[model samples]
Target: MDSSPHKLYHVHGFDSRQFLEHYFSDKSDMAFGDDVLKFPIEKLRQVFAVGHINGDILIDLSIGSLIHHLYSASEFFKNIIVLKANNRCIMELKRWVDERTGAFYWGHTSTLLQEKEENSDQCQDQEAKVRSAIQHVVKYDLEKENMTDPLVLPPADCVISVWLLEVISKDQDDYIRYLRKISRLLKPGGHLMMIGALDITYYLVGKDKFQGFTYDENFVRKVLAGEGFIIDYCNVKERTAVSDLTDYKATIFIAAHKEK
Candidate 1:
């Protein structure tokens, strides 16, 4: 079976490498992480299975085409509350949405107005461009270091974070805190399906050393258990190829829900 996500007319060999490279760059360490590739299949299946997802809001951290796919597939697409936490990621993703006219909300770790005032004309235009692409988009400023404060986010039925937990917290406690905060963004009894890497590294804003977090399946399950999320389905696996042939193993995907 061909695993490439974007197959035209069911024809394979589309060479998605260029598309991935242009956006992901040599930072395959961060870009093509396990969640980036696997969640398309895993998340989609989970979302589809929950046939009642119509009218549910979805917040996506680190924007990608997954929302677009979900949008196209479900009657619930219009009800999704989309979000991209990172600026650079949102910028690139906004470009994609521009071409496709995806509807979403772009949440920023920083203020959008300040960025417009400080950045160059090209930069300002980019933000405007993203706004033009979507029928509805809202930008919110959140202090990246602190996720504890009550945030004014759109009410969501389900919150999905693909490849996001690794970037927010370094250790188990902080990771759990961040997840709890994000989950709070959703209404009670909502679901959450997240895909995180087993061992992954990345730099925090102003932090020099790119830190890595490693969590086995049990560890993650325990964390979620405390946060009112019960693991419904999980699959752990490894992948063998990035750009430079330097491979990595990931814990793969997990789909869970906030127990009613």
Candidate 2:
């Protein structure tokens, strides 16, 4: 596929609802269920259960309004602060958080997490836990040195960022810049769990095409080290589900803590 002449995500707004339907919906046939939903959840469940990566506060800055990864995390943290780049995402997420009408049904996702925990019938209970744990969802500007400046957020115990750099960053250096900015939000020795696509340059959400920043495992490690993080765990899952939505060869998960 040709990679040029694409619409920029920043210039043209994204459709968060369309995004959810195309990939995250359980009924969608775009990709197999394991790659999009279960893989990350299981990996995170393992990491969170290992007795590391915990504290009072976790600040989430994932792509779109994704909440699947938070199910494992809600079990560990006392408070989860979600930071978003746009109001649409904030509102979309709030609908689910508030249980407003027509909200995206994440019971399937809740059920998946529950099944992993061997609590096969606690889907409603699991959903309630997530809704209770996620106490705040605030909008922020990525371009600012302090993304949540003026609002004054407490330093996070861990920052969970998923596929955010794929669209917002222009290049590798830009990716590092955003990485550094979010790192400052962490207390020294605080953890960061990042999930990124390897060697992907673009993705389509609905009918609109948006850019995905290209990078590999080596580059990811280089950037993390340069930003003074100590790598504790890294996992790469090769893509098994075929789809026209994205072109990532594999999904990479890295858990690291800031060097104190």
Evaluated with TM-score, which candidate comes out highest?
A: 2
What range of 10 consecutive residues in model 1 has the weakest lDDT sum? 5-14
Please report, in order, the local distance difference test score of every candidate based on alpha carbons. 0.49, 0.84
TM-score of each: 0.62, 0.94
Candidate 1 residue 60 C-alpha distance from true site, Å? 1.4
lDDT of each residue in 154-224, candidate 2, tens digit only: 99999998888777777878888888888988999999998887888788876677887888999999999
lDDT of 1 by residue, 1-260 (tens): 32222221101111222334432333425444333443344455455556855444566553232332232123343444455443444455555557555433322201232242334343334334333434433433334443322445666676667655664566788678778777777777776777766765432221122334556778888888988887877877665445322123654667777877
Q: Model 1: how far is 177 from its true place, Å?
A: 1.1
* Clash numbers, per candidate: 0, 0
Please give me the total number of clashing residue pairs in predicted model 2. 0
